[model samples]
Target: MNKHSITLSFEINEPQLLLRDAIKHYGISKKALTSIKYEGGTILVNGEEKTVRHILTVGDKVTIIFPEEKSSEGLIAEKGDFPILFEDEHILIFSKEAGLSTIPSREHPHGTVANFVAGYFAESGLSSTVHIVTRLDKDTSGVICVAKHRHAHHLLSEMQKAGTISREYEAIVHGFIQQDSFVIDAPIGRKDGSIIERLISQEGKYAKTSVQVLNRFHLQGEELTHVRLQLHTGRTHQIRVHMMSIGHPLIGDDLYGGSQKFISRQALHARELNLKHPFSGETLKIISPFPKDMKDIIPTKTTK
Candidate 1:
């Protein structure tokens, strides 16, 4: 078992309130309380261990020690130079690099973003669970959020399902886009006879994407359009397939008939994220600049 502990301390606000009620009032879950009772956790009042049934007065200092989570199976924490944009008690925002999968899969289980985060948590002596709130494609680079514990994870997941978590992306497509701004409203489903590829079909789930052209220029005699995209509904390869439907696939995306002359992977980056914090209720807007490979693929006027 891991030796580190997660401790939370606060003063009681109501007089004559029981320890369990105070904990619940402070947003601690009933399941966590059960863990404290059965999993060697501790509860203290004014530096002395107390039961949840004990009563409390105003300004009484109460502390709860949460034990370490047992190490999960098949997760080998490996350290790396992770780019952290923001971190707090509840969550973390990381700028994920290209070529790294967000989580482990059957074929490639190690060197994933989750493994890197586990390593960071271990090195920091933290015992909290690794909870990824947002996942990006393996070749996609940009900001992703990770919850430090289960409560935060639950809140964020609820927000995502409610369509409150907003994400923006940037990409360089193969052809110039004529419209300044437009939306793609279509349904997406697994391509027939293919397990991975997705297509636009009537018998698919609803998907919407908003696109705005940022820059239109020529690179090496090939017309390229730099565009900003907002996803109304998350779908596998939504942007890529939508753009392909309009005859402008992402640069270097071989699956959608894009050229690989400029870059080896898809020219897509999750550039921005906006959401409300689970605990603080404060708005968070995180942004990440384009990676070198993408920047080089869409050169500015000065370089051209």
Candidate 2:
């Protein structure tokens, strides 16, 4: 077995949030809480192991070890040189390109954003305690935040659980977005018997996305629509499943059978992020444009 070690001392008002966010920096595929219990590592809080439900005080020390597992790709580590969108004392945001998983997966162990980010940290001598504020699908590209320190990680994460951060995405779906603006308010959950699947449900977790039609046009015998999606509640693939439920899956997202006509990859991009700066207590908004393919599909003629 291989072993890796990390140590952090922080004034934490919350421990569970801190641990959960800390694990994200490792890019573990499982949920953070699950990672803590199952990652085969000893986690000591101020030199003592504690449960996730434990209440923590300030001045607690955290020590963790990342379990050694074979890389899925079985390839030599590659830097990948993923681009950065914004950075501050508390957070670092990346413009995660499409076709890249946010973190490592079994089949795609390498070439993930997390792996690249991890390599970057090792080279730059930065803290390894990256905290993911939110998650996007592998095919979805956009702004992703990583906390630089454990304290800020906990604070920013608590703010997220309290619904302080706002995120938006840009997508080009398969059909005309006839409505000027509409809402996809629904619940989402896992599909039975599938480890990598999602569906809409009545008893599932609640989620909402406000979709605004930027333009609509016809291209090569199929309806193409440009849209902006605002997430009110984050759920696993909520937007993708919701859009497919409405009969207009994204152009390339066959996972939801989005569009068989033109798009082959899920046509989604994390375009904007709004949140209060953890250290400054000031609101920060970051915006990014859609990829070249999406931008080219825009209806310059302007048909709503």
How does each model score on lDDT? Answer: 0.85, 0.71
lDDT of 1 by residue, 1-304 (tens): 2356667788988899999888887667777788778987889999999998999999999988876565545787889777788898778898999899989989888999989998898887776668898888888889999988765776688788899999999999987788989999999989989987898899999999999999898888988999999988889889989999889999988998898899888899999999988667799899987799988866657221
Worst 10 residues of 2 by lDDT: 67-76
Best-performing candidate as measured by lDDT:
1
Measured by TM-score, how close is model 2 to the native structure? 0.73
True lDDT of residue 33, candidate 1: 80
Error of 2 at 275 (Å): 0.8
What does candidate 2's lDDT look like per residue over 55-88, in tens digits?
5555566565433322223323448776787886
What C-alpha lDDT, on a 0 to 100 scale, does residue 277 get in candidate 2? 84
Residue pairs in clash, model 2: 249-258, 252-263
